[model samples]
Target chain A: MTDTLTCANLSKSYGGVVAVRDVGFTIAPGEAYGLLGPNGAGKTTTISMLVGLLKPDTGTVVVGGADLSADPMAAKAKIGYVPQEIALYPDLTGRENLRFFCRLFGLPRKAVRARVEEVLDLVGLADRADAKLDTYSGGMKRRINIGAALLHRPELLILDEPTVGVDPQSRKSILDGLERLVADGMALLYTSHYMEEVERVCDRIAIVDHGSIVAEGTRHELVALVGGADRIELTLDGDVDTALAKLRGLGGVTEAVRTAAGSVRLIAEGGRYLLPSVISTVDGIAAVTAVEVVEPDLEATFLHLTGNTLRD
Target chain B: MRPHPVLALVAANLRRHSRDRVGLFFIVVMPFVSIIFVGMALGGGAAAARLPVGVVAQESDPVAAAVLAELRAHPDLEIKTVGGEEELRAGVRGGALAAGVVIPPGSTRFELVMTQSSGSGMAARSAVDASVGRVAGVIEATRAATSAGASPAHAAELVRRAQAASADVEVVGSDTASATPRGFAYTAPANLLLFTFINSMAVAAALVESRRIGMLPRAFTAPVRRGAVLFGEALSRFLVAAAQAVLIMVVSSLLFGVSWGEPFGVAAVVGVFALVATGAAILMGSLVRSSAQPSAIGPPLGIVLGMLGGCLWPAEAAGPTLDTIGHLFPHAWGMDALLTLSRPGTGLGDVLLEVAVLGLMAAVLLSLSLVLFSRRTRTL
Candidate 1:
């Protein structure tokens, strides 16, 4: 599938300060791609450039096979961007705001009412269609903001921290709406520091930092690159020293962690070999309750690659 | 990816503006109230209503009392005590008294002073001349009878006959049909000048808001040319100004019976005036980053310009230096053109120079705004 949006060597600077530097990435059609980065890691800057809101000092952006600067109208037609801030007029009603954007896009009169109702319903805001935006709750406003971008039925949706500053219910609704859009064959470029959200939605991700992509892969592919290790967590009653010694001495084991109590754990490249060894290492342990080895999640893989939590 | 539907957006913006309470209050209530107040203040017809003229006679002589009392008896003329000539002039200036009559220390003839404080000083001059003329006519009649040796009954008959005839005020060899000019004839046109300017300048908010909301960016993202957005915004403001000018004209002409100089000539002058206001507002608004600054600064700035332009008062009342300085503002030229058109028997030929100059001013302002807005956008 062709990439709906592409940026090569994208770089931006504000006077002496560098905001985005040498970043390159592409969002393929019908695929949900995440741009995961820390708060000040240039996520917003990249989105701004890709959307043609900010001019990049050095880079090329092509949206829907059209060069943004060279052929802007074609690019804008395919993209729907939900801004990071509440941008609609506060005094205007939700329906009124939607109609304005619809008109701005030059939508047909027959399609306008239907599209407005459709998007509002999709965002779970059909009931609040007539309410003033200023009177809406944070969640309701967020839904309406997203709904506005959906007015023109863009093929590619660019959501910039869509869940930021939103309540859990609203965030879920937004996430669900995004997923529904993608399922309907719309391509999405979703950016956020929330790794779980990225992992839940995106088929592929580019972990960005300092205006560049540090890692790019599927969730499992990234973990393998970091030398996949099983996270073996256990609870025990006694013999903490012996357990730590035995697990550490094992050939395949990478590290043996002992709790302040007698509980002990092991992390290794191979989970099968270390499981029995760990069980035997902790002798005389009371009520050895649980033993489970799971694949490294995107959170662990992200932390392993970036050496920082996604929340940061 | 798309072309911006500028006209539709502008229409939506206009719709929202119509409902805005703040905008409504300024566009509607301000003019309505000021017209009533200012119209009665400068008036014969029912606007700025008329200033109350007070008369005080230090002379308790029967002749002097009759003159003062005769003025008090005139219809629609409100009379109060006239303290002194200076005080009466001061009252007129302060808008308390339209005019005042002070009888000289011994002579029966009173000193008359009219205030040039209002849009037209006709109300003040007439109010004063009528009051003082009555007393003077009575004294003159008494003197004539005494010198001719007429009897008391004959003198009474002569004075009575003289009192029966009222003297009329002739301004520039023409008698005003009414005591003062009619409604927007007195106010609406001035307000038209004021509102067009204020509305155009305040439109800076729409520009600022677009920037803040990222609408500018999205608009640029469209294959839409940068010129389109610039043109769209300027066009929107100009359209608003035109609408305001038309609204004021219609209301003034239809409701207030205000006769604009010549219909076609007035329309041409107002059109250019609207253009000037539109360009000025866009240039100023683009210079500022925040929408709040434009709305805040544009009105007061427009008011100051309007004051100079003759919206608040006639520039003829200003000193020569002040008049020259006031012409630096487009409102001054616009108002001048309007005045020429409004005066009796005047037509397109009379206001031709004003129209040409104002049209040139609008062209310059529009070009300047285009240059400024483009330069700022490029730098951004």
Candidate 2:
């Protein structure tokens, strides 16, 4: 059996506010899954429950096929968590910090020494492992934070906002590290609000919103759910509904949304094949000034499903 | 068993603690140095005190000069000359002379008169009394032996028999008196107090730092139980605190020559006090977030507790009110136990109440801290 993590009907609410409601998903072994969402979505809440950092108000969390809440130690043994906040001890040297976590996972002394060296190399902190974290730059601290979790080499790794608030170079390095972890046959449940990150790294993506998974599947599969491979956006001079109505009448136009500023955006299946048709079809509207045909992006898929920008 | 995750944390914490030179200095060195400094400040030996005194001689007898010379030889007494009885009385009242010695005219006797309630006055008058009493007895024995028809050598022998008495002091208290600690004996108890307090601050900082760094959160995510974390933390703190207590006992006795009374009893008291401080650090760490909060809060609290519990000074000097108030601090109970243990000649049984109370307090505080700490980790 694949060592996968599953959350079954996990629901949590604070008073009258539901944070994660009836959320269910599973990450296959060695499969890198992204829990993508906008701000205020249930991504973090679900990650919190899945990692056993929180007990869901209703339902159960299972890691590596073992119930998390049922036998936490057993469930936790198979999982490593890299929290959103940088969690490395600032007072300790990188080597010392890794050794500290290695013991926490019960690795033998010899194994601990080996693992510390390995993790330091993995995180690109091998040369700087002797330096105290307070002396490290923000990027170095983030890498050390990730290294602490990687020391034990658990079956599953959970990273909450894995690349939050880092320089672009560090963020790329972190993503590269995550990809390598997956290649090393480690399953990952990565949560982030960054659309490009999810698209670039995850094999499967689940869009979470308002405490539920509104849409989820592989990137191509999910974009295919919208039934159109391309989305065309038209900026209308003053009146957008007139142009949107004309665009909707054209063949290959699957859906059309008119934004508040008179920009009409059309999500169409087989967008590339229908781009010329869309341009010629909307040419009669005369209100259309600019047209752009975009490929199936997480942003468009997200907007198609949630009616809001991925950032929003 | 997967080598208890908390034990690993304990080792790391201890390592970090040792790395903190400033904290280690405060924990291990400050108490040791404070003992030496405070001992020097208090007078390291049972040397006599110099008291300001007034002497009123109504008669210009040459015997009075002889008495003054005898008084000068006693290391503890410093006698001063006064103009008249009125001047002596005024000097004593105005706080210049601790007491006044009046030698009445047409009489062979002398009188000691001053506020007996003052420590300085008591010390002064006691010194004067011993010297005068020695001189008077010898003279009286001489007259009596001569009257009884003894030879000059025989009279001197009688005087020797009469005058050979050990020096003694009669002390009394008043408002403006400088309080003497039941003297030289406050060292052992005070050292116990100071060591416990400094170690507690260091432990508190360690605990808070662990929480802030997310080490505690990471530990909880592993196969480690929260109880293990709490116990591990306590163990680390106790290790440091126990070492601190041993240093205090050794230093106090070696340098101050402070008799720590029953050796085993002193060890037991120190051990229990360390536990109490460990629990307090855990509690403070759980109740706050970040190292700054604990570092900021621990030392000040330790200092306040030290003062209230009579670590820097004796709780005895604080009297009934402050003494009762001092019991609110765990250090007070520990100090009281130490004081009983070091009271020149006190057995373990003599401090049972204090020991039991301190033990109970340590148990309760440790339980509360464990409960709080476990709650914090249980979330993750």
Chain B global fold similarity (TM-score) for predicted model 2 against the true chain B: 0.68
Error of 1 at A83 (Å): 1.4
Q: Looking only at chain A, give the TM-score of model 2 against the true structure.
A: 0.89
| Residues A19-132, model 2: lDDT tens digits | 899999888888999887777787877876777777898887778778888898888888989987777677789998888888887887778888888888989999999998
* RMSD in Å for model 1: 8.1
Off by over 4 Å in 1: A13-19, A55-58, A228-312, B1-4, B46-112, B116-184, B222-224, B283-295, B348-380
Q: Please compute the TM-score of chain B alone for each predicted structure, in the order given.
A: 0.71, 0.68
Clashes, model 1: 27
Per-residue lDDT, model 1, residue B6, is 73
Which pairs of residues collide in candidate 2? A228-A268, A228-A269, B117-B172, B117-B173, B117-B174, B118-B173
**DockQ scores of the candidates:** 0.21, 0.42
C-alpha RMSD over true interface residues, each candidate: 4.4, 2.4
Tens-digit per-residue lDDT, B44-63, candidate 1: 36343445676656646665
Worst-scoring 10-residue span by lDDT in model 1 chain A? A303-312
